[model samples]
Target: MEKYGVEVQEKKQVKEEGLQELPGTHENIVLRFAPNPSGPLHIGHSRAAVPNAEYVKRHNGKLILRIEDTDPKRVYEDAYEMIPEDLKWLGINPDEIVYQSDRFDIYYDHARQLIEKGAAYMCTCDGAAFKELKDNCKACPCRDNSVEKNLELWDKFDTMDAGEAVLRVKTDINHKNPAIRDWVAMRLVDETHPRLGNKYRIYPMMNFSVSVDDHLMGMTHVLRGKDHLANSEKQKYLYDHMGWDLPEFIHYGRLKMEDIALSTSKALEGIENGTYSGWDDPRLGTLRAVARRGIDPRTIYNLITEIGVKMADSAISWKKIYGLNRNLLEPIANRYFFVEDPQLIEVKNYEGGKVIVERPLHADHMDRGNRLLPFDGSAYLAKSDIADGVFRLMDAVNVDIKGDEITYNSTSFEDARDLKARIIQWVPAEDNVNVTIVMDDASLKTGLGEAALSDLNVGDIVQFERVGFARLDEIKDNELVFYYAHK
Candidate 1:
């Protein structure tokens, strides 16, 4: 799998330094995972969270959970709620949760301070006026307004509804980067914010809000997607102008691809158009979807670990993700027998007898011991295995299949060789065993009562012995209901 871009950058930095750790311990070091509440976090967002939380944890520092809800037009209620929940589910519990919406007053105060310092001014130039000027954006005629007049305009801005006017910080319009040319610090937006409601209109842009919040939150490090590196430089300028302590800024490459869309807007459109189930749809790669599909949090952590944090952008494969998940789950998952598309087999002419088959939970690890399976004369085995001429039952016992008849001589478990043929999973049909096994397609319904199955509960994970890993999807009236293992 291709490594994440951020991982590449980190490697280069480390090679140059010949060390990973900073010189001395910065005991007060603080990091943050600031997710915008415009949409539920996707797999790409999860990638960002892993390293950030790890850095804080390794340093025994604080990880602040901040919500950047400045984009009032795009923010959603459910999206906001999901931000923290997803982080918590991933085993990343931030020390504090802060919302930019709640800090409007603080942002406004800073905007006023900039005005008073002659560093910012109100720009009434409408969108049309900006487009007409194009590359040579003419400085607003009010750019040189007196401090007294600017304060009144700032006060009016503090009280006006959103979208009314914008406060732009003074910067050279001829600067090489267009983004550095007097970007808006605050804008008047009257739209109803999903989280804050109609409380106020003035909202800070990302560059302004992040810089202010990082400072106020006492953050010592700011690690984010490299797409925001330019914005980081802009923010550094603000910190310099204000004479405030500047945090270490590290930008990693963004998680993106050619065919795969990463924009929340595109995701929302897919849901609205009925092209996807919802934000949690497995196909979308959102955190909820990945969780629902049985991808463990540790798998996500390991995935990012292998990729490392760097500046070169890359695309990760779902296969690599599953491989990690399988490794993580191998030790804990209980083994059971499940044969999808089962074919009933009868040992003709033999008296009905029962055999206690002991199958190890993990084939490679004997310390896990074996699980007991009550096998009767009649059992359901995979139809494909029966057609393949031979079937190896657990414990290295081979059952020769000729036409519809399967003949096997009883053999001592100790003397049996490891099953050379595929070990076909079986469920005792004569013992009234009820199992709700899931296949690649539809879920199966066995006649046995659902209560008898062990290690199968809603959300409980299990490996169907020789079949595959699965999660209990539903359990009702003592029946096992499982979903196909995602890993």
Candidate 2:
């Protein structure tokens, strides 16, 4: 059996299996994947996006891609386009695309409704002062203002500068969670929104905007991080105030990927400081980075689905993703030869002159055709594989190496097997392309790849025989650049 065959089989079984039933009414099931457009969608974002999309597909429901870009400071202008492009690459097609910046009026109207119902109030108190009062289980002085007064105060929001005022939802002041006690619903942001510009001074807070949108947009299930569990309690007040039916809130566990940075702000900082490349830098966990490395979107989908919406936290290593990705790439990615840090070896006592080696692109799938390589008596083998030994030169010849001497032996696999020979890959010294592989650590490995690699276009994933799998990233100036995916 092939490596990861059982794991891949298990994944196939998971694909055939359905997720546990959602708790709410099945009729008109709608889900929304609301990601703040701080940066391109990363693997963390996929954890939320994939499940919603898969559930929608299973139930024949609607999935909304909501760009929660209300925070002018955090919004990345490029993310407005990058987010959708990343999602499209992930095969998650939202039924509707909406931006929170476009729905300020709607959020404002909902705020007005809460104010009219005396369930929300505009607090002109300083942030620190309001926090002091709320911490003591006491309402801020502004909290007691009349509904009419609050409405008048809300009307004066345009006149308010940033940080001067915020609309607070009426929650239990004595609630155990101080963070939830009278949470701010909306605040004044004087900064120009990336999408909206200076059109409005007031902006809805994440919880407020998310709650309002989920309710108004008819979101049937709200898939969110477990960290939002308290926010879930906070949003319930708005639902109660507006007499709106609450969406089924599903709080999934925290998915902390080991060693993979998911911070958009930090990634942007790295890019700006020249500490890293762009969003798709090999080290980044962004979907673009993963895609550039030839990681199939289905790998993410399958992995996330297998994790499902469990509340138990999952801390996964890159190996987990690589294992799953390897399963998906094994049967598809073609094979080639890449000799890293090449050591030249003379094929002495070779009766054959110039030989053309035609190896199958994919051993199991012969229909994929062959990769042809013409070998003379000289070949480039990796320096690490040049130790004294009896070795098989892949589809070429068997060789006996002792010290500086390397002499050709019989080519029969049976003969090589009889001696328990090591198998090593090699590229013909003269008939190879200069290749550079960008490793996962953002390090570069320069080598000589089989001339056949030049035929592969950008974005093609290929296994470098004894080397690992890599995706062709660029072909320029007679050199092939690849991003190493995994072993």
Candidate 3:
């Protein structure tokens, strides 16, 4: 499975997934995961963050967790704490944590240096007018502003009103990419920053702050998406003007995940309007959301490692994740019976009195012990599983179902096998615990679980026999709440 010097994951039963080697050789490989404070990390973010952390681990280098909070209007105050928490749950621990919002002075210093070198200037042109000039490959009148005047405006930048002036980096006006034509380095954001408040108004743009910090932090290698190719080019100009060496930039393709909501803004809107429960709502692709559904952090690690750093775009489905997660959960997760939309079946002609059948919690690991299921001539079968045919009540007895009447046929598992009867999951008719499963689509599936489920505590991952895997989220006074993961 090796490709382009990257270690490939073997096809079957590998202990751990492998990652491809980074492009260049280096004594110190410094990488960073810079997430914006606009929202918590989603599934799309892990495509960039996990590889950086894994590469650092493989090279024995430093990994930095930088929170990009330059945009005050987009910043969600709570994400300042939530981002790191999510990373911790994913088993990613950074060597250093940095906040772009905390380094305003650093950015201001670099902005001044760019002006002194005539690499940047203050542009006071109207937005629409500047775009027309830029589109026509013509330099603005402010492009030739004296360094002294630009520095003077820089000193008075904070006092200026929003959109009054902007500091622009000098680039080729005739460049093929219109976006590269003298991009804005600093702007006046009138809104109050979530962290620093109204202490400052002049904030460096994303490229300016990112470029400055990436160099100052001694990053040796940078992992980015192909969409950021233009951004990388834009940043190199900043490095060139500063007389600093550029870090090796590795760009991968866009990762598109189907049937999952990855937009933090939309998720927040949904939460505000009562359309979603919270950030951990099952419908979202947030790490917390996946974690709530019994998805192991190792599963996420394996997924990214297997995908590696390919240059081509990757499209994935939730089924791929469920398949990987099931392998990790199968041997460890204990099994139990849960009957959704239960139908009562009275077992006639049964001679047994208060039959209690003990089944192994896990078939492969009998040493872990067994769960007891008591049947008192009455049991519940899922209504969907009940048809006009013979079926086996799991480890109990074989029965024939003929138009609402269930009669005991035999007790031998062999007889049920010979009759080709379907092995169906069942819960005792009495003392079954009420259960509510929060499906991945955020729909609720209410059902009855075996009485033995009462002994389990929250945060436990278990299989619901014929049903799929689920994480016990909460235990109410009369019911257990679980979030469905996958089949």
Candidate 4:
């Protein structure tokens, strides 16, 4: 009754109720998101996570969060801690958490079992000699070694230096895909792991480790990039040798985002050289960056769901993602007047110079209430929003400009909404709040916002009328600093 190496989960029969029955979700599917902790969780990683979580929910299945942190050289302490936080931010909570490093002994046990079964053998062949042999489709001489001797060398991995010996799973040396031929099952790594810190020497490569873990953890289905199609075939060989059921492998296309760095190494280097502010830099495609830009988690979830489990590569356009996000935010984000690169406009020849303009928080959603924008004859408008003849200060008032003379039109709100007037965002020049927008490329756009914006709490996402969607990051010195999500 063991479940994922621990508590037993009661399996429920899956009920099909959807558009298309996926390849591997016919039963009590146990899916997982195995992320190597060498970097933060990027959007590419979420492509695996959010959809799998939906499968577990829809199919009454269990989901495992397996941290594949066996590669010591590239592992980072920050990455190890940051990954789960990012997943939680994406609304993913695993039913079980498995750390590969914590189960070194378990992987060792399976490796030894494969050796005893003659499915794997230890190779002491010199690197150059073995490469030539493998290149020529010839088995290493060590492949024919006796079981007792193979086990002996396997145990002596501790006494041997890093490259002196390795354990190779026995496969057809003439395998069609050369990369899958005689893959390394276990090898001595001389480096210390960030977590384990020299606790073990011999380590299993990704293929053997993932194959073994998936089987041992009772994984019923696997959704991954087609780049691992070869690896999946190699693992199938191992599964066949071990007399195990092959998990349903639903391959998917690559999710490529243009002009966004997803490589952990490249991002780290950028951060090191001050090219990026941090992992949450707006330029990155990491979940932290996406979240910082105020894109909703549901935006990512829905996007991946649309991608589904297809076996083709997809280069998702930034415009598509932003467009999707804008759709979600427009309905909920409260509207504000943000004047960018302000141009001063004075209303003259008026009966009373001051007017308190009342605008709805959302034009379509008057139920949410309104904001009080007071203009004492002086207001600021966007330099681009200014035209020579006529315009309306959105929800505020209508003014007619003729030869440096601005004449205040009727102050009736209904007339302004009906005149077919060119409506533009405006703020009182004297009492406006300082608004600083952090754009996607990390540049700052400083402007004036209606003083009503001062009431917004941090983390409140709003749309500046005619500007774009932005998330308030912080409030300081009577100014609101926001991260621009999208227009």
Query: Best by TM-score, which number?
Result: 3
CA lDDT of each candidate? 0.71, 0.89, 0.90, 0.85
Stretches of candidate 1 off by over 4 Å are 1-25, 131-134, 158-164, 256-279, 363-370, 395-398, 403-422, 432-452
Please write out the lDDT profile of model 1 over residues 253-325, one tens digit for every residue.
7665323564778878989999766776545667776676577888877677556567788788766777878
Structural RMSD, model 4: 6.3
Best by lDDT: 3
lDDT minimum window of 10 residues, candidate 4 = 10-19
**Among all windows of ten consecutive residues in candidate 1, which has the lowest summed lDDT?**
15-24
TM-score of 1: 0.84
TM-score of each: 0.84, 0.93, 0.94, 0.92
lDDT of 3 by residue, 187-306 (tens): 998798888989988999999999999999999988988888999989988899999998999998888888774689999999999998999999988999999999999888878877
Q: For model 4, how does the per-residue alpha-carbon lDDT over 1-487 read when each residue is reduced to its tens digit?
A: 3455443233444534431356754688899999888789899998889878888887789999999987898788898789889989988888998889998898899988998999999999998899888988999899999889999988888899889988988888898778888888898897989889988888889998999999999999998889899989889889987889999987888888888746988998999999999999999989999898899988888788777777778887889889889888889999989988887888875566677888899988999998988877778877777766666777667788776677788666677767667777888877788889999999999888988898889989999877899999999997889999988
lDDT tens per residue, model 2, 5-31: 987887665334535667787777999
All candidates: CA RMSD (Å): 6.2, 6.0, 4.1, 6.3
